[model samples]
Target: MSAALDTHGKAHDGHDDHGDHGHHTPTGFMRWVTTTNHKDIGTMYLWFSFAMFLFGGAMAMIIRAELFQPGMQIVTPEFFNSMTTYHGLVMVFGAIMPAFVGFANWQIPMMIGAPDMAFPRMNNWSFWLLPPAAILLVASFLVPGGGAGVGWTMYAPLTTQMGPGMDLTIFAVHILGMSSIMGSINIITTILNLRAPGMTLMKMPLFVWTWLITAYLLVASMPVLAGAVTMTLTDRHFGTSFFNAAGGGDPVLYQHIFWFFGHPEVYIIAIPAFGVVSQVIPAFSRKPLFGYASMVYATSSIAILSFMVWAHHMYVVGMPVAGQLYFMYATMLIAVPTGVKVFNWVATMWKGSLTFETPMLFALGFLFLFTLGGFTGLVLAMTVVDVQLQDTYYVVAHFHYVMVAGALFSAFAGVYFWFPKWTGKMYDETLGKWHFWLSIIFFNVTFFVQHFLGLAGMPRRIPDYALQFTEFNQISSIGAFGFGLSQVFFLYIIIKAIRSGEKAPQLPWDGADTLEWTHLPTPAPYHTFENPPTVK
Candidate 1:
């Protein structure tokens, strides 16, 4: 690769111009193998995340199929357990987290006028770590006893009873942790150290700010998870019994440690979605983000509050009344900052020149549905209510609303919002609308009934159910299939857009205010900001 040149044909260190914009991009397979370019790495991350999405969706199909008629007609009870376990693990770690990281890789540098990530080689290493870790996770299922059936949480005593698959899950978690930590460090360094001459921290884009907070959340919380899982591994193999009551260790200790990590892990997935919505809402509304300073504070508060509420997930575990009360209030307190965010988004869109582009549609969908999820979560935060609903299908409905409808929808918004810049081509608007409507309707079809199921007494993680629960289960199953198939339509839209969609203008969205849209070239020069751009 040759040295990159600026728009004026001068490199940063005053070298001569490189031949063409694409001149330095290595040809053939080695391009992906050896490149340190953030765009290429980001593209790889996005594609990898999508592949895992499909794989995890397939697992979900198996699960829904087994639950369709309440008789275990498809998979065995054991396989059903494994499917549940890995489906959660894959969707969270493989699909959602990495998709955001991919967005960071592609956008952060451009957004802030940096040429590449601060630690370029380390960025490459971080992404490459995911595939091997993913392999360990997927390969675990083919082992003699199938994968860990202990659910993604891998609670302690249940974990100790697992087969070789547990070991693989442990390793995969460790590797994924390492990758996340490295990626966080890279994001922190790039945003902190590599911004243009005048781009101060307060002046950075909201997406950049969200990532900065998310990276910290990852750094603070991943180690706790690592420690919890490591103890589980020891109990299973070396007989340390860190969670064994016979060895004077309480299983509740694992819950404390895991949720300490798990609760923030929720924000780690969500804050970025918030960032995406922040960016998209303003762009479509033709207004500045309504509360930039407040948005930053709200995000920071949410991250801080995330730590205090980890115990909310354990209200049913027989903690003390005082402990339950404290967690309940702390959990509910999260709604303040969250409500601030929702208000700010609506205010940004208030009476502005709003347009219903594909991205804006998804962002609006996220706001409506995520708020519904939040209300349900608030209901669960009530200690008395949670005890009744814990481990039931109600719990399932709450999170899918937050995760699939919330995080995943915003992710789609981000992709559609940025698709033009990424490919320098417009996606088919008609097809995009079709995909969104189908997803919205089917997603509701799938999980909405589970709310009633939980209220009426249906336990989760069970292969079969009582005859009274059969009708809702069948409805939910059919909805799940329709939702899954909608993505196939989504995939086609994306491919068609990339191959032969209309050529997008340099600033595809007229409301965009960021440097990437204002200053960068269409298709974004393979090498961006070779000469650092002035923020003003």
Candidate 2:
């Protein structure tokens, strides 16, 4: 991951080149609204994702509050279902996916030695599409019959019978899909065509490699999702029977298509996270990443295998013995490449000059918890085990471990790792560390107990539970509130860093050797590589 750059023909700062017509950056609110600069757009993506994170987190708090006791306390069961559905939808599409795209917008060009995204104008449009989609999603709650409660998967017959809000939800999903496809196109084009002279594909950073594979996954699978929803829309109104059982369509067909996309969608979120951890672990360990070529191969392997394992989610949906066996073994096959990634990260840190900076701490946290998530996933991959725990809180605990600990924690690590480059200042290290500990502790408290709850035969997505489940639910709820507050503290740390932190030097991390750290200035110039740096 660490490569030296030839300093010959060094690129000039963007602000330094005015030519005949001086550059005129837009002022006030319009600066953000109209800007084509990658940094400006990335900032907007980050803030937007954080906003959605809060919205989703608030929904989670309500859920926990109601589940704090054994009976219904606040929301009606229908509304409770809506909260779960919307929270999952908002966090996955609105928060996690966009957050990585934000990182891509900010980092990919600079890391690969390109001046900007391949299509800057399209980049602007990609971001602008998100708000309308988000509005549609949020507004669904206010409509007659409230939001669709068919779960985040928005499964069949139930979705067809849903009210006007399902229409809104479907349309919102369409818009979000459009936005992702455009962003993926931009990333793929930029990475493939825009590398500096002499920087080959093999020479790209692990983060770049991870995203390159991820973008391919997005381009392929997002359309499948779009198709699934479109079919659902047609069944709802246009007399199509794509998923309508009464109209001669098999509802199970919807599960086939949805999980085909859904399983890869899991990787689509996770692969980029793997990329971030790959970068963080190597840098803080003060070692060049162990087995860079192997990591690339492993990532590609995961993407290829992701398509083969979708049926594991549908084991209890009733397939043949042969079908179940194939899906089970194929699903377990994913663990091999995933295990390679985990091993490489640990090997990268083994007996090296180590540091526990906030970024490193979070990366370490991701390593432990994400592996735990993978183990749980393995447990779920068995046909018999999944039949027993299919819709239980165990399933909930497994994925939250994967999504929250895996993706969200990695995003935190990336932000802290690059905060100096973005802000041109140092955040208070103590406060940042405090934020991390609170998050990891509260995070474990919240989700770990759910595994036991699932094992004890408690089902998920219900507002009420049997009396025996009350104590763990209370513990989980208390931890949920703490986790939510810890994020609030994180927002404070970021604001304080932007406003009053100490000035940063050109290179903050001694071991960070990418173009952004090695060739670019602190608070990287708005434009870079007007003349691409030569890689020796």
Candidate 3:
């Protein structure tokens, strides 16, 4: 009973008593296969996300392997296109999307002192939809026409020409986007309505606040995407001229709607990472976050700015010069609020007694390298400069710096930071350190040179390139392979920690001061906060 109690010694006697024996545990494979407990749903999200991560990484490996030799040694042009398309789709919708949701599923109810997500069964529906959708995306490769060869953006006419696989991929994107909207709404309703009686908005943790911001973005952006993609579907099958220039519709219009949905989605991924690292750094640095109020305002500012900057991605699409300049300058303005965030995080650690735990290492790495990515983004923000760099390897290097080094690294940070709380077991600090160092080193080695390759006029998405670029390509391929392999170490550390490790305490780190820390255990119980603990 003591073990089962919330920190306040509250015990649940099951939601209802079925018989003398007990209430059902919702046993067998169906528990995961069909159930919707936040914990179970969170497990599904994390595993699904990891699978997507591995699969996406494999696609990258293929791209790297193909690029290993200069002249399209291993694959044809068609197959190479599929690899890039699916990799981007899988990484964005399948991997990164679910990871943030997984955090929401696991942490929101606990953090907000709710019994569970508001629509538990709908939560089940939301998660179950993912595998089917993912299968559709993956199965696109096997279809008679090959996979969607157009990029994940699925720009029209080119996409319209692709095989049956493209149709399946189209349907899959719509489905995944819908699932995300549903989940975001649930998170919104649950956080807003189900919070404990006294927990005010500002009192909520940064993680929750960021999710709140994210869910709003999701609710607003996803439907526009659904509508746009749905229209794309109609244009392909139903003879509408929405994105078909030949049918009196301008193809450029699709870019506008797609990006309307697209730009906010970037922050949908990064804001949660912002929340996660915000939590990790403060804890390890033994200080409350620096400028907590500013951090909140900064996050809100980033979200607001997301809507206005969508056109920046389309700078080279031959928009009027005035339009291009407006986007460029407005996009450049995001850096100010973003800079506020980076400054606040550093200030959080400044002059504090700090520890070099794995999470903190990853968090710090995120700050440094993600800042580099942001700077490159600023460079790309110059409309004149972007005319030269657009669609080149420079753009490739810039975004990968942002997405891979930024979002991916932050996910690793959160996992390490929260591992003890999730598993009630202590990970081997030394192995974690090794994993961190090797990953950061290899990651930089792989992508940093890509900027040079791009500026040298090497385009992205090619199966092969000119002979002059061979050496860096080879070294990059080697680094890419090493980077993927090093994840084995990360996996081993997690499994080892799960199976057997030193026991961890509720407040495993001295400075972990959240309500979740106080109310839960080293590995939190399956259902936490049956009755909300009074926040001290």
Q: Name model 1 segments beyond 4 Å from true.
A: 1-26
TM-score of each: 0.96, 0.97, 0.95
Give the per-residue lDDT of model 3 (tens digit) for 301-326. Answer: 99999999898888878889889988
Q: Write the per-residue lDDT of candidate 1 for residues 387-457, one digit (tens) a residue.
A: 89999999999999999999999999999998888767788999999989999999999999999999998
Report the number of clashing residue pairs per model: 0, 0, 1
The best candidate by lDDT is 2
Point out the worst 10-residue segment of candidate 3 by lDDT.
1-10
Candidate 1 structure lDDT: 0.90
RMSD (Cα, Å) of model 3: 3.4
By TM-score, who's the top model here?
2
Clashes of 1: 0
Model 1 RMSD to the real structure?
A: 3.6
